[model samples]
Target: MRRIKTRVFVIWSLIVVAAFSLVGCGSEKQTPPAAQQAQQVELNISAAVSLKDALAEIQKNYQAKNPNVKILYNLGASGALQQQIEQGAPADIFISAAPKQMNELEAKNLINKATRKNLVENKLVIVVPQDTKLNITKYEDLSQDAVQKIALGETATVPAGQYAQQVLQKLGLWDKLKERVVFAKDVRTVLAYTETGNVEAGIVYKTDAISSNKVKVAAVAPEGSHQPIVYPVAITSGTKQQKAAEAFTEYLFSAESKAIFEKYGFTMGK
Candidate 1:
């Protein structure tokens, strides 16, 4: 009986030893996190198609500073972007080229009112392919017989398109030129139409024309022709990463960021 009890005790002690050894090995081999995990954040930003180049520049610096955050941009007309937000698209930030679209979203309670801020201001311009002698020195020139292919964003949907219509109407040329208008899905597409010679001329934001060397600004739209072109940005309600969204929005106001925007021909809203 004593021998059996000793054998049982030895077996129990061996089991305890084995368990301790396994725990020690685990402690030694267990990998601590190499570094603070990049906060896995996905920020979906909807911006005006006109901002493609400028925002692309900002994204590089923004990502470098906030390495943990991932930014995805949905670039299109402000109106379309607003519609998407209203439909509950997964957008974290909304940057509209026109105040009306931002106001529309605000009315629907889709934006974080506290985070709303004016990001930049842009001027409208008529552009043509490089070296084109359309002699388009004024908006009324759009009505000329020679100018058959006039590309503009669809006025009903795109802010740029709406602005173009307003400018033409203000100049008393809307009625005559309405039929000649070639509607594009977005201002960028309108710019492309003119740049690629698909159309002879197009109206787009001056900043957008400067962003690409493929086109040249033919005329600056008169200041009184349309409402001020203001870009307002706000964090959307669908954002899971509110802090990251707000941070990115605020980054637009930073001096470094402002300079980058200015380099692309956008005036700081402030």
Candidate 2:
């Protein structure tokens, strides 16, 4: 009877060990691997007011090709844009209508010097209201008392204003009509003033005048009137999206992008 009891105990011990092993294997925890991270980037661009049309088109094309990237743009007078960038705006790239303001930013180390490139060229032109049939072609005609007020960008900092001042000086009309000039914050403001009849005439860019049917070109400033107009694009040093920003700077030089810029009356830069 004692031997039978011993055999039964051994059989029960083997069954218990087998049950324990099966439970350990069945209860093992399996955790799913973590989800893969998404690769999305946002790029911010601050550009001159003159680039509004071209930038809009370029943004569309870039997004179509790179679905992962999102672009945000700030467009204003070149001086104002430079001020914003200096004040720590989160700008990935900058496109300035004039080089002087860009040089100032570059001096302050606000933008990457190596990434700078002359993207396009523009021409200045005088404009008048569309409905008004003004035959005042020569720059000297602007000095006539009938002209009352002529609008231009503020010459102190605005590129368009500076160019206008130079043109007036070249034509020997600046001293005669200084008092009659209506200063605007930017070239677009000058266009607005002329379109609304607030000023008899305005000095803006040829590309600008072509965009608006509300005004007619009075004359394109002769090449000698002002320094050559060149647009420069640069990548800001503060950008967090370094690769995206660099790609964008290069995109400005792409032939497809140049065609879009030319559609807005911009000339190809040398």
Candidate achieving the largest lDDT: 2
The local distance difference test score of model 2 is 0.88
> Which lDDT value does model 1 have at 249?
79
* Per-residue C-alpha lDDT of model 1 across residues 147-205, encoded as one tens digit per residue: 98899998877888898889988888988988888999998889889988988899999
Give the range where candidate 2 is weakest over 10 consecutive residues by summed lDDT: 29-38
Model 2, 154-250: lDDT tens digits are: 8866898898899999988899999999999888889999999898999999899988999998888887889988888899889899898988888
Q: What is the overall TM-score of model 1 with all chains considered together? A: 0.88
Off by over 4 Å in 1: 1-38
Total colliding residue pairs, candidate 2: 0
Local distance difference test, each candidate: 0.87, 0.88
Query: How much does each candidate deviate from the true structure in C-alpha RMSD?
Result: 3.4, 6.6
Which numbered prediction scores highest in TM-score against the true structure?
1
lDDT for predicted candidate 1 compared with the true structure:
0.87
lDDT of 2 at 7: 100
Q: How far does residue 43 in candidate 2 sit from its true spot (Å)?
A: 1.0
